[model samples]
Target: MTALTLENFLPYRLSIASNAVSDAVASAYRALFGLKIPEWRLVTILAEGGAMSQQALCGRTRMDKVTVSRAAIALSERGLISRASNPGDQRSHLLTLSKAGWELYEEVAPKALELERQVFAGFSDAERQLLREMLDRIETAVERLEAKG
Candidate 1:
């Protein structure tokens, strides 16, 4: 029988590495902007895509509705984001970054790139591209498996 060791398991190792990087990024975001990971995710998504509903954000960010809602609420409270009634849907509001939020995003973007550089300093451009491809492939495989189930 083949013995299963979690330490040697690919999924387990990936999860651990992902969490480690997430924690590091979370710490920097919290310290610099008082933003949690979910909030930062929402901000980045909104920055790139403009107005969107929380449901849309959830789908785009792969975050649950509850997490997206909480982040939206926090950002609204900070005056970093605003929610306007959706023209097409009365039940859902579209969220957008306020001017202040845009300014914050400008500040955060460079810091984020710097953090990524610090974390992946050893990787060459090709290696980084390959890693991204591998991760994308893994995500595609997992999605296919999920669909099958």
Candidate 2:
């Protein structure tokens, strides 16, 4: 039988590392902009992808619908994002960053990138690329497994 240990498990280690990075990013965003992880994710995605539906945001971010909905409601209340009628689906509205949100994003983006650099400061450019590729491969493998089920 194969020996199993949580500490040595690939998924466990990945989750731990991911949480550490997310915590660091979340703390900085909260301190600088009073935004949580979900809210920041929405802002970043909207800034990059332009207006999109909540469902699309969920698919892009891989975040659950409830989390996305709460973030959208919070951002809308703060006047950081606006909701417009979706042409194809009247029941759903498209979300976009407001002028204020864009201004905040402009300030936040550089800081976020700098924080990412800090997190991976010891890694070489090649190592970073490899890390990205490895993550993509893991995701692809997971998709295949899920599709088989």
- Over 4 Å off in model 1, which ranges? none
Once model 1 is optimally superposed onto the true structure by TM-score, how far is the C-alpha of residue 25 displaced, in angstroms?
0.5
lDDT, residue 91, candidate 1: 99
RMSD of each: 0.9, 0.8
- 4-80 in candidate 1: lDDT tens per residue? 99999999999999999999999999998999999999999999999999999998999999999999999999999
Q: In model 1, what is the error at residue 128, expressed in angstroms?
A: 0.3
lDDT: worst 10-residue window of model 2: 24-33
Residue 19 CA displacement from its true place in model 2, Å: 0.3
Candidate 1's C-alpha lDDT? 0.96
Candidate 2: give the clashing pairs. none
Give a tens-digit lDDT track for model 2, residues 16-41: 99999999999999998999999999
What's the distance in Å from true for residue 68, model 2?
A: 0.2
